[model samples]
Target: MESCLPILLHSLCFVSLVLQISYASDSISAGQNITDGQTIVSAGGNFQLGFFSPGNSKNRYVGIWYKISAGTVVWIANQENPLNDSSGVLKLTPQGVLTLLNHTDGIVWFSNVSRSTQNPLAQLLDSVNFVVREANDNDLDDAIWQSFDHPCNSLLAGMKFGIDRAKGLDRYLTSWKSVDDPSPGDFTYKLDSSGYPQLILRNGSVVQFRSGPWNGLRFSGFPQLKPNPVYSFGFVFNQNEIYYYFNILNSSVRQMLVLNDNGISQRLTWVDRTHDWRLYASGPTDECDTYALCGGNGNCNMASSPKCVCLTGFVPKYPSDWESMDWLNGCVRRMELNCQGGDKFLKFTNVKLPDTRLSWFNKSMNLQECKQTCLRNCSCTAYSNLDISGRGSGCLLWFGELMDIRQFDENGQDIYVRMAASEVGKILAFSRQSHSEDLELPLFDIITIVNATNNFSDNNKLGEGGFGAVYKGVLENGQEIAVKRLSENSRQGPVEFKNEVVYIAKLQHRNLVKILGCCIEQDEKMLIYEFLPNRSLDCLIFNQEEGVSLDWPKRFTIINGVASGLLYLHRDSRLRIIHRDLKAENILLDMEMNAKISDFGLARSFGGNESEGSTKRVVGTFGYMSPEYAINGLYSVKSDVFSFGVLVLEIVSGKRNRGFTHPDNRLSLLGHAWTLSRDQKFMELVDPSIASTLNPLEVLRSIHVALLCVQNDPHDRPEMLSVVMMLNGESTLPHPKQPGFFSEDSVSEASSSSGGKHQKIRPTR
Candidate 1:
């Protein structure tokens, strides 16, 4: 009986050992094997490659997905091919390339590439991109090929979406055939570098939509691209490649730009808080978004009652059809042209110019020379500076009809339209007599800029601007910087061009903005400045939702800091400066929300005994400019003092000085604030966002000081020194006088520039 028991125990132990070895055999390796239910995990456990079916489809495909997030499929071995059953095998050859085979050993998909070494390895990077290379060489430049370089419809962070010009490999996104089918679909997105670089979506050989050319700021097509917390965008255009890519701002965040089966491109970002994905942005928001809805020689503006309008010289090709809203026929020139008759060019402002695909370019020609060159060739319909930097160097001539024009109220490109000869003569005579001059800025070479902003990717954007865009960058070793690239058609250019460089460069102060350097190359003029990461104060103090975070102490500190900065600009700086455009947006915040005056684009530097300078141009913005400056073109340091007063009141009230409101008088922020202060209802003016965090005494004192600054009599306004001292609680403030343009009894008729009208709200035209 004892002998029989020993035999049974030994049999049980042998069975257990055999079962363990069988389970281990299902593991995967280079020459070993993997079957239907098996997967090969990368070294860091970041990626998993195996056979799996997608979205309930029984068609088994060999693919790679993140190990941490099992649902994130990054690459697929069989996008066009699939196995009938689960009997699939994935293997890495000794030569380095990976291959997948079906149950019959038929090659399903194989990565074919030249291998330098006898032994090689396949690696999946921490960024979730898979690569193949020689055993000892991990450098990307020396690699054979990578799955990242050959992406499907999904564009993940760290992936490039552009042309590999040298390799003749143009990477783009192709939509899926259908929800259940993984085959390529009709729509394809690619980087078109014909003139300037632009993102274009195509249906076969026809373009469906365009993301517009990179206009030194955001894409001309996407006005909604603004400051966001999750990711940053960038474009690379050098000798090696011309690509557009984006990266996750947070390392833990996962995001993807995918073209789904529905022919829509969507950007999806993972939200850890919800344990789900969130939509970041969507394109083609309206019918006008359909590529060139107005067709050739036409402009589209959603805000307009009729979105489509023909160019100045063009009339509808089919008048009856066009009136009925069918504009596909586009437009035709109203008059025949004879170049010998002295052809004229009409100026179109605030518009995304026509496409430059079939255009001729010369980097040396200015706008004037460009006009002559276009006239010399009868085929030339329009001509412009190929590059819009440094007095406008370069000439690009268009011979064909202009296509895909759109209006952008904030930042649009300038394009001159061809007109009859007599029209040019009349316009040219009028312009030459008025003596308006163009501003010139130095342009930065494409390479020098690449080294400046790490190629101007999303990570570099400081924030969006009304005229253009700003980016933060670092030079070699360590020189932090901010770069502002102005749009070509910004109405505020010439003044801003002079104010930022000529004025700010000559003045110096700790509290004022600093100019580091300038770049001028071809048409790319950029101003380099010291980078400030805390962004502008408006992002913090006025955001009712975000203002709650600034407690009483922080608010008090900010108030004092701004006063100090203004004092330096107004009194202590080398030149007694009047920040004519003083507003919340002009005040930048440091890491501590410490105020530093910036955007001196409208600032005036006064010499000895000279208190102010006025211009008929009326350059500053509506909300921030003093009433005298906005209404009568009369400006003085006292004018700036009035603007400062408005800013101070806004800080106390946590409201915008330009767009403030009240039910009784319908006055702007300044009027409402004055009324509340005079009635001892000043506490009511404090922003509700920071109500719980403010001290009543400090708030009241700041409001009083603000009222004194806005006094109607320029003689009664206090100097910045007095204002700063009052904020410090070091000196007694004077009693307030009647505020400028602040009468509650007689409401000013509201008017706006560019035909916009509102009630009781006077705006700078």
Candidate 2:
């Protein structure tokens, strides 16, 4: 009986041990201790908390790391005080405090909570946050203390990298002293919340990089920080807190931002396929990323040689130094300011708003009030919107010389710089004289535009484009006009705005839209043009109900008018212009359905002897783009010819060139047209609405000309002059070859190799 009792006791003890192992939790209660070599894994098993030695160091430190990627430590508890031997013990006190104790019960590190609580517990969360709170509290916000509030060199997902205004707690990232050492290094990345909140990286007290102020979408300096499939990010600025955070969209994906010992901040993502961490992006990406690289009153453009240039209304302070590529002295104002009421502000677009370190801000001021406030202050050098969310609100004014300004290819903000009225007038006069061969364009005031368009009411909106929205406006004299208002979020800059004004204003033809004037006031940019009662060709041709109104005759007339406009632009206009973005949306129609070419923002003007030009940045619609231009960035008059060809086909078929598919095969509109023409089934290609009213000969002739224009080789396409003559039955049509971008496979391959879809490629216009 005694032997049987001993066996029964042993069995009960073994059962108790199994139950404890099965129910092991990632939490420690009061008076409990987790010694070295023991780990507490989160409930989801995503993170583990234990003592570890970083890199090659044998010294032990309490930390938390991803459970899957065992060696990747995210948070360190005893970073400054490393233990020589493996005698570390992590414990939770009865006062809701978490502390790390040494071998002799000596306190090595502890969490300083504002208040003590009963029934305390320490938990290692899946977010890699080590938290201490009341045992019954499940809410993370109710935690007494969290490791995320005191991050190490790595900023993990769900961590707030910002400031708590109410608590005066600033959470920032400091680099590690070395790969083997977790102590603070020389570089620190923090959010400067003084004027307009922006992220700045500093090496000690010296500024190394400035991540331009957060515009509605992202930091102006980080144009590449766009929405992606992997993660979502945003910035928050309010009375209580100001911070930036990012969260991964997919739970399987792991991403973190690490400020390396070398002072480079890198965004790295774990690549499962590669079995390693891949660099997603890095700060200080180029020479222009250097803080104040262009110095005061200077602009840096990475695409340009020497990278630095003086801002408009300013000249090199030291010409010799600037010429030698040593632009440390920057530039000085060309004309001294008199601080009179007659002073005007010159607006610079597509640029990183200058440093806000020495700036003032108002959160409730509109753009007009901001300009007025700046104009009233003699010391104000520049002014811009403090917050660009929604319709744009608030104001930021810079008093001293603007610094650290750089040019971005896209996604930039606008700044209004104070300039003498005389200087502004002189600059306008110089611009006018330079293009005096064309008609002089008038600049309208903001008030006039506002009253004309009823404050840009939604009901007055005509349409929207990649650049901005268009509104219907009427002058006091009863002159109806179409107002093209540039949106604050638009990537189009003053360069394209001025280009359209200069080119379209000078172009005179019954088939070309007339530009009446332009308006540049405060932060607004708009162009006024003669209103076409029938709207754009897309609103009609693409609509089944609208297409019924345009019979064969009207459609033929519309095609002929567009060809004439293109011919004039290619040869007859004062400037030999190439309408790179010729499309259905850019074609306006009058009351009589007469087509007029519009939106010349992407047009390029060539010298008399220059036949072609190449650009690193290709700009145009994908479906209308010429194969040579879209693939190699080589553009010429023939590029317009190809776009005209696509427009002609769309008008005939009532379908967009892009996204057009056939049941027979996966061919683009151009390819489908070519196949139909080759089979002599031209009548089948015409729109069903106009099928009954079709003039067979004219339809066949138009399709043939379009096919010739879309030929793979640019040399095979006819010039606009020849195209006009052919459409008028004045010239013989040649047999067309295979068209460019015809196969779906080729399109897919091109899109994949380019790292984006065809529709995602933005038109510079």
Q: Which portions of model 1 miss their true places by more than 4 Å?
A: 1-29, 32-34, 40-47, 66-69, 114-116, 193-197, 215-218, 223-233, 238-240, 248-250, 363-369, 385-394, 424-765
The per-model lDDT (C-alpha) reads 0.67, 0.78
Residue ranges of candidate 2 with Cα displaced over 4 Å: 1-23, 425-499, 502-765
**Model 2 residue 763 CA deviation in Å:** 19
Candidate 2 lDDT for residue 487: 85
Clashes of each: 13, 0
Superposed on all Cα atoms, the candidates' RMSDs to the truth, in angstroms, are: 17.3, 19.5
> Candidates' TM-scores?
0.60, 0.60
Top of the candidates by lDDT: 2
lDDT of 1 by residue, 138-168 (tens): 6977777688877777788888898988877
- What's the true lDDT of residue 558 in model 1? 73
